[model samples]
Target: MDSLEQTMADAQARLEAAVADRHAAMHSPVVGTPDGDMRVMVLRAVGQGLAGLRFHTDARSPKVATVALHGRASVLAYDPVARVQLRLSGPARIERDGPVADAAWDAAAPFSRRCYLAEHGPGAPLPAPGSALPADLLARRPSLAETEAGRAAFAVLLVEPETLDWLRLDAQGGQRARFVRLGDVWSGGWVAP
Candidate 1:
């Protein structure tokens, strides 16, 4: 056991802890959407470090432009078993085309792709309430052309996490951890939970 080996072991522990923290955060009830609405789930995406988070919405969705204009948003997650909660805030960007979009489009499942092909965006008028897909279309799934159209309509949100608040619950007491990013550097500290 060398000093370098010890250091590497400690770093690995921290990374594992961070992932556990993220998983616990996802299961908590405190997760929130940008609209101040509480019913939405926050999905983290691939990028550099905690560089991206994704939320699916119609191209015409007001939230699409809202996030673009504000460039900042927040997420809250709570866990009962761990008695932990996490809150994250960061700047956001929209990726509409190019490799990023193509990759995400490729990852989407067929059912999800159908939403993209629909003519309406979020909250658009419905065709009566119980209307079925046209008979011919129902018999066959949407073709690649239709799927492509929907993929084009998708707007991928890339959020670059700037700060994170990690809260842990304890029977006797609690704890808090905060991380802030400056340039490429990440500085973190523990506080009262």
Candidate 2:
């Protein structure tokens, strides 16, 4: 592969690793606010799709509504160890029900699925401060069959990228590149960091 191709591949690998690291807080969706600001939230991504990243969220989530209204979104992931920052911008879609959503729900861990089983939507006010689950389910993880109840609230968020800015902050020097799809080929080159 050529230099730009190599750079993009290397960056993609680093981004995938950073995103797969559950301990890292690097994988969050940043949605545009009405005032043109950005709101970032901790979200668990299912994986990367052909065009960009895919993640899971509650159908009742404010983020879901935000994506619906704006259609555009961004995801920023930084790996301190790799000294790499991946900034992905794109149009996002919320899949509430379909083969893809079903597969995602089925693949989720019971603990992760527990969030969907809650009695109230995210950000709902509680009469008293607590775990936010149905009172009866507060003590234990939901059973597999019980997970079915959460499916209705589960959704898949797909981000189709228009651009990916890859920045490497190495001690030797800093290099940045922006990747964009043009026809069947990838196009980008080193730019100012």
Over the full model, what C-alpha lDDT does candidate 1 score relative to the true structure? 0.59
Query: Compared to the true structure, candidate 1 yields what TM-score?
Result: 0.71
lDDT of 2 by residue, 85-180 (tens): 777777788899888788888888888899898888878888887767887777788888888889999998887767778887876688888888
Local accuracy by lDDT, each model: 0.59, 0.73
- For model 1, the stretches where C-alpha displacement exceeds 4 angstroms are 1-39, 42-48, 127-145
Pick out the ten consecutive residues of candidate 2 with the lowest summed lDDT: 41-50
- Runs in model 2 deviating more than 4 A are 18-21, 24-50
Q: In candidate 1, what are the lDDT values of residues 1-193, reduced to their tens digit?
A: 1332342233324333543455633532233336664445435343344556565555676667777776766766555565656566788767777787778788776766776766666666776873233444555577666677677678776666777676666766866667787875657776666
How does candidate 2 fare on TM-score?
Answer: 0.84
| TM-scores, one per candidate | 0.71, 0.84
